[model samples]
Target: MHDRPAPRPQAPPARPPAVRRHNLGLLLGALRAAPSSRATLAAATGLTRGTVAGLLDPLVAAGVLAEGEPDRSRVGRPGTPLVFAGSGPVVLAVSVEVDGVDALVTGLDGQVVHRSRRRRDHRGLDPDAVFGRAARTAANLAARTGRTVAGAGIAVPGPVRGSDGAAVLLRAPNLPRLDGCRPAEHAGALGEVPLLVGNEASLGALAHLGQADDFVYVSADVGIGGGIVVDGRVLPGARGVAGEIGHVVIERAGRLCGCGGTGCVEVYAGLPALLGDAGAADVAALRTAARAGDPAATGALARAGAALGTALTSVLHVVDVGTVVLGGSYAELGTWLVPAVHAELVRRGVATGPDVAVLVSPHGRAATVTGTARAVADRVLGEPDLLLAG
Candidate 1:
């Protein structure tokens, strides 16, 4: 037999492959947060100025970063600042919803360079077919941009329970066909670019940064999913189901839900439930009816808001998140539901007027897509070395 080489021993100070990747990620993340001089980057990343320069030079040469004039405002001798390249690569962000799929390409600075939507019925379609179409649509959009596609992020209507490479959709009642399917793979949908997959509401909450550091985001659609964020970070929980409040029991003996439960919050607050009860075609029709003083639509929305509040109260008692931000289809008609939701929260002592109250996402249904952009950007930022290699 050929001689076998002995295993290498653990070394100190010298960075191995993992350590180098970690430091690269740290430096890139700090740069993404804000443009800074090499000295500031060294301080922020806890690396020596020499080390920082050694790492930052390659990125600047690769068109991933650009140097700006030194900031003379600082106390000591100022160094030239570094910023993300203006016309560099962009992230291909995609979202797969129950109704349709939307895709957009955004720069590292979070500017939307291009966006498109495939408006068609996705419900009941084969999971492989739907995901294939989505992946191909995203690829086409990125190609049209004619810019480097750093990576991609896909937000699904279910709890994701894995890493970016091999994520699995745990359960999706609305898109039942996607249950237990890997979002990146279907009948051959995974693409050449790196991919990141996350729950839609979770990503929405991630994108909800700067609005409220601590709040509960309600992604109201065919099913209502809650995303709990504390100190600006989402709580994914033990199994990626932290904010799944759709099954919270609200009415002891009420209507049966699709999850085989009776009186669950979804049976009352879900878009399908609300629309069926109000006899409206969709949120737009419901809004028109409510604005025209139609009792059926108004009454249906009122009950849904109440049910939403009740479900949130149970979660609030434990999480104690004081703010509730509504997104998805809910934003289209949030005004009609906010009052009742606020009233119930007040009655339950979980809310106290303007200080702790309901809010609406300005991005509305687009929140998930924007959030996916952020995620994909981070994915590339974390492994910037790969971006240059490709």
Candidate 2:
């Protein structure tokens, strides 16, 4: 019997509280864009004035929001502006890269309040040790700023899954000790607060969200990874490992990669490879050598760029995205590497888009941490009752 397509699994309706949170998210989003009074928010969100006021009043009372004086405009009667509370609430976001860790604090108005980084070789180290160091960094920052950390987001150098303050690091070839680690659990050891763990490249791409409608964010660093954004949002594929271009096989029997794969893109294009090939102690030295017309440094950049181009062609064949944004260290080194990437793309006949752009993110090395802060900050501010309620 054809049995009516199994009744389409009867979707459950959203409860009233759930509906309220959704509306609050909309209102918070509008207010975050720019502060406005109840009337203006209602018009922008298509919600009734009563609904906006009802939802906003409690937030204002709870110090999540504040009312400002009338706008000083000459053309019309001024409306009292409603704004995010200035003093206390903030988000702590951290990114655990292969080389080290970086943490940043962002306020409700989307300003980075404070940031700190620890540069070291974190590869093959214990995950708990690294997380402990990160937690301490966060705690010290909190003490310095005295702003309550409303939420936290952690970015890891591999695939991850979960939400609402909990996630598991599925695999981390770059940082082997982090494999199967629970980032949120460690974050909880600090205290009770919301948390999010995401792939580093994905979060890094998020920092440049408004830069382009569709582009691939290439986070070239100690480990190379890609984050694909299509139609203005990140295209996180099934199992959340959509943009793992670092593991792409380029040269058979070549250098072994952290992922246990030989001749992968990362082994060819990652920072360590570039640095080693140029015989430079660090990025600064490499840049200086290149500026002085050092062949080794210049050649290293070109070879890395070529490897990146080869990796990207696989992405373009399937995704049809045009622009490729060099993020992380790539942004800083774009002047030396971009031409080779473009030349390689042209060689492959894949630089076919009308605009055909390869851009550098303005955030530079801070993209991952900055993006994570922005994402977690949105959650804390959007869901007042869940995160901000006493």
lDDT of 1 by residue, 131-216 (tens): 88898888888888788888888888888897475888998877788899988875244357788888888888767766887998
Global Cα RMSD, each model = 7.5, 8.2
Among these predicted structures, which one has the highest lDDT?
1
The best candidate in terms of TM-score: 1
User: Candidate 2's residue-wise lDDT over 249-314, tens digit each?
Assistant: 888898888777798888889999889988989888988998999999999999999998898877
Count of backbone clashes for each model? 0, 1
Q: List per-prediction Cα lDDT, in the order shown.
A: 0.82, 0.79
Clashing pairs in 1: none
Q: What TM value does model 2 have?
A: 0.82
Candidate 1 has a TM-score of 0.83
Give the runs in model 1 whose Cα sits over 4 Å from its true position. Answer: 1-27, 39-52, 69-79, 187-190, 238-240, 293-296
Locate the minimum summed-lDDT window of 10 residues in model 2. 1-10
